[model samples]
Target: MNEDSTPQSSTEPARPSSGWDRELLEKLLLEALVEQRKARRWSLAFRVFLVAAIGLGFILAFKPLAQGGLTAPSKAHTAVVDVIGTIAEGGEIDADTIIEGLREAAEAKGVKGIVLRMNTPGGSPVQSAYVYDEIRRIKKEHPALPIYAVVSDLCASGGYYIASATDRIFVNPASIVGSIGVIMNGFGFVGTLEKLGVERRVMTAGDHKAILDPFGPVDPAEKQHVQQLLNAVHQQFIAAVKAGRGDRLKDRPEIFSGLVWTGAEGIELGLVDAVGELHQVAETVIGAKEIVNYSHRETLLDRVIRQLGTSVETALTKLATSSPRL
Candidate 1:
């Protein structure tokens, strides 16, 4: 051994003190830590993905649990088409959907009868007429199959319009029955514009093009024209009700005067045939106990999109025209 050399133990190996080894060890440690962090992140991401997948599965699994799921029974049953909520174009209770449901129920095997489950404040006149016409056509095609309207909380205006087309109108004693009229309402913002010092300059090809413009002063001629239009629609509505109800409707002026009445009063006025709810109408009237829903139920995504579309459409329509409604 050299004089200055340090002696090593027989069992223990020599350890290096150079900075290179320390640097290498530190680099290895850093690499290991980074790998650990990456593994933890991957595990967390996987868990998040799993949770999201499970949530989606639950939504899909429970879709049929919603009222009036898009299905019918194999056995004899009363088909129900819900007319709940506003019955405007693009709405959940729109004419197209109602007509589709009616056609489906009429076509489906073992569907003894169809019940229009009415609970709406009513919406567009055109939409109402669409449904009413569809119901009449269905009745004409299927003379044996009885179609009935069962009013719940409310069945007014356009709602009643659709109901009138049914073979018989059943209602709860307290259910609101009628609003057989047409209206076109709006506000005149001319005074507000004057107070705000806002000048509205509008140009139109025709003289009556800007009729019922809220920002302009009410023109007597334009006002008269709008009134005439409303009256025309009102006559159409009256005609529909009279044609559907026929001799069942009482000879009363207030029936077509847009006055709402209770189910009992409606029966007296011949607006409703009897005082009965859905179950009663199904079991006693239709002679079917099992009630299968045939209504076109909207999915969550569909409802969201429909609501967005309806909002935009309504806003635009309000800006453009004060369209008549039932």
Candidate 2:
């Protein structure tokens, strides 16, 4: 047989890969890589946000510690104690808080004098009385360290009661100084309930237990009893003012009433000693303008507000980065 005629075996052409194979594989790989990158970025961003939030929280938490130093003052400085907001039993300006500040100031070395920065509309008579008594006790214990109350926007009612116990009260000329009276306020909704056909159902063990309940009928005897109670409290309030004011108070019948007065008028009526602000009082009276606050840590309200701001920032960052850009 001729070499050429032996005839070579026919071999089939190699089949091209399936149309979907290369394209689909590349598409899937690209999609996976992109998704992985996005996931990584999101995770990094979330971690950053978390870290920033934590840092902010720490800053706010320790800010108060950085501001206050009871025993660390090596030089003469005016110790400040803030009595802001309502002076209630459970409030920040309560007896325990103020007393704590006063004690620290009493003990702090190089402290020439203490200043009570009061800005309150007043609350809780019992709380005020406690603070007043504590002040007198502190004065007796540390007669050298005088406490001066410096009033802000308002120092009325219980606020004034607390200030009265101090050696002197300094206030801004426009500051509201006094509301030397007690009041037990309530609302009577019986007429409204009757008009709306809303039946009132309330029970009490004692006859006079719910005397001030708005749903009940008015009792003349209860009213008289309440009035007498108010009168007794008023008398005590008057006595306290008289004792605190001593000869400084002028003979003014309306001074002990519930009427508020400006700082200027308060000075004229002997309710306030002089027109001055916190720093001014510190520089002039304490002879040390550098202030050192002895109050408690930063307020809960400040923390809440800061937390809310951080949350908003984190949310906005996530929203901006959640989607893919072109």
Q: Candidate 2, residues 27-52: lDDT per residue as tens digits?
A: 88888878987887777777777867
Residue 101 in model 2: shift from native, Å?
A: 0.7
Residue 48 CA error for candidate 2 (Å)? 30
Off by over 4 Å in 1: 1-70, 301-326
Whole-model lDDT, model 1: 0.87
Error of 2 at 245 (Å): 1.4
List the global CA lDDT of all models. 0.87, 0.85
- lDDT for residue 223 in candidate 1, whole number 0-100: 88
**Model 1 collision count:** 0
